[model samples]
Every structure is written in C-alpha cells, then in structure tokens.
Target: MVDYHLHEAIKEAGLDLTKEQMVVLKKLHDEDGLNQNELAYLTYRDKSSLARLLSKMEKKKFIVRKPSASDKRVNQVFVTSYGKEIFESAKPFVGKLIKRMEHAISETEKQQIISILKKVQTNLS
Candidate 1:
C-alpha cells in the first residue's frame, strides 16, 4: 500500500513527522490560525481526536492554541518557531518523491492525472 511505502520512506529518511503531527502541521502551513473545527474539516480529523493530538503538540512546544478575542468560544491554533523549524526539516524528506514524479510525467499529464484522481476519490468515497 502507498501508506506503508510512505511510512517506510519517512523512517528511511529519518524525518520526525508523527502521523497526527504531520497532518496538523501541514494544515497550519496551508492555512494558518485555523480554529479547531476548521482544522478538523481541513485535515479530515474528528474534533476529539485532533484535540488530543493538539494537546501533545502543545506540550512539545510545537503549537499554541489561544482563545480568540472576538469569540471566546473559538480558539486559534498557531505553529511555534520550533514547529516551523521541525516542519521545514521534514518537508524535503516528505517531498523527496516530487522530483521523480515530475520528471517521469509531462506537465499536461500531471494535470490530467490530478483531475482523474479527484474523480476516482469522489467515486470511491
């Protein structure tokens, strides 16, 4: 499975991307300061599960969740300096296959592939 291959690649590359940590960090990278609900939707993680993961990340000093002044019920999540450093370190390793993937396919084909893959995902779900 691709998941197995991906896990092995991360291990072989000696990257520090725990499954939950990687998802949350990547979600933040793409869209910073997303509240917990927004994060759960973006990352496809349930709220309670994400909460536990966020708690651990907070303890590690990788992230901070602060209550919004505009809305006391809403808490915004932010990656810390340490998280940026760690995520930056992981990016190259996680993206190691990109060069090969791009090299092996034409630009047009890449677009077509992505379009077809999206349809496949929709159909499967």
Candidate 2:
C-alpha cells in the first residue's frame, strides 16, 4: 500500500518514476559509482532484475552505467544530473508520506518499531 501510494504521488508530481526506481535513484544519489552487484545487495534485488531496472533507467536518462576503469567487466552506476533533480523533487513527497504514515505513532513507539524492525532485519540477514 505504501509503495503504491508513493508511486501515485510521484506520478501526480509529474515524475516518471516508480517506487522501485526511486529507491535505486536515492541509493545512487547517496553514493554514486556503485557496481551492479553492490546495487543488487543494497536494493535487495536479484542481479537480473536490477539489470532490467538499470536498463530502463538508462533509457530514461536517469542513470549511466560506465565500464569500471579497474574492471572492465564491472559497470558502475551513476545518477545523471536529471536524476538528481528528480530525486530532489521527490524528497518532499517522500517526507510527506513518512509523516502521514507515522502521524498516529508516538516517537517512543516509532523508536521501538525501528528497533524491532532492525532486529528482524538482522535475523533475516
């Protein structure tokens, strides 16, 4: 539901990005030049799926995959200037969604939820 709403919000904002694509864009924005495998791990997506997403993003001019200088076989992903702009534009929508989602939850409850989610993530890892 959250993902669907976020996708709709992006669409309403006149941005052509899915929630998944936004995730990739945000990750690259935070740390550019991440290799395909690294991105796969970070995004919890399989290599094939990530490759497809990257291909689509490349076509959209949101990102570029350059052959790594040290490893020609590895393609490092970087966000384009346009991608950064879109990401920046989407920040407010994301913030709004987060705020709305947490409106009924107190800070202490939010902290506990975070702690529990972290533990669950660790267990899965």
Candidate 3:
C-alpha cells in the first residue's frame, strides 16, 4: 500500500521513475561511489539483478559507472545531472508521503517504532 501510494504520487508529480529505480537513484544520491556489489547489498537485491538494473539506468542516462581509482576492476556508481534533477523534483513528494505516514505518531512513538524496526532487522540479519 505504501509503495502504491508513493508510485502514484511520483506519477502525479510528473516524475518518470518506478519505485525500484527511484530506490537506486536515491541511494546513489545519498552516497555516491558505491560499487555494484555494495549497492546490491544495500538495496537488498542480487548482484546480477542489480547489474541488469544498472544497465537500464545507464541507458536512461540517469547514472554513470566509472572505474574506481583505487580498484580498476570496481565500477563506482554516480548519479548524473539528470538523475539529481529528478531526485530534487521528487523530494517534495517524498516528504509529503513521509509526513502523511507519520501524521498521527508522536516523536516518542516514532523513535520507539524505529527502535523496534531496527531490532527486528537485526534479528533477521
């Protein structure tokens, strides 16, 4: 339901990105220079699947993969100018969604929820 809401919001806001693609873009925006393997782990995707996704994103000109200076074999991913523009444009919509989702929750409640979710994630890991 949350994903659907976010997808509709992005579309309504005139952004051309699927939720999955947005996840990749957002991650790259937050932390550039992540290699394909690191991105796969961070995004909870398999390496092969991420490679395919990266290929599509490259064709769209949303990202560029350059050979890492430290390791020639590693490809570091970075968002392009177009990708940054799209991410900036979608920021308001993302903020709106977050605000709506947290509407009824107090700060304390929000912290508690975060704590619980972290514990759950740790348990799973």
Best by TM-score: 2
Off by over 4 Å in 3: none
- What tens digits encode model 1's per-residue C-alpha lDDT throughout 78-105? 9999998878877776687556447768
- How many clashes in each candidate? 0, 0, 0
Q: Model 2, range 1-125, lDDT digits (tens) per residue?
A: 98888987888788888898999998998899999999999999999999999999999999999999999999999999999998999999888888989998999999999999999999999
lDDT of 1 at 41: 81
Score residue 64 of candidate 3 by CA lDDT: 96
Clashing pairs in 2: none
Task: Name the candidate, 1 or 2, with the larger TM-score value.
Answer: 2
Q: Candidate 1 vs candidate 2: which has greater lDDT? A: 2
lDDT of 2 at 81: 95
How far off is residue 83 in model 3, in Å? 0.5
Candidate 3 local lDDT, 1-125, one digit each (tens) = 99999998899889878788889999998898799989999998999999999998889888999999999999999999998888888889989999999998999999999999999999998
TM-score of 2: 0.95
lDDT of 1 at 74: 91
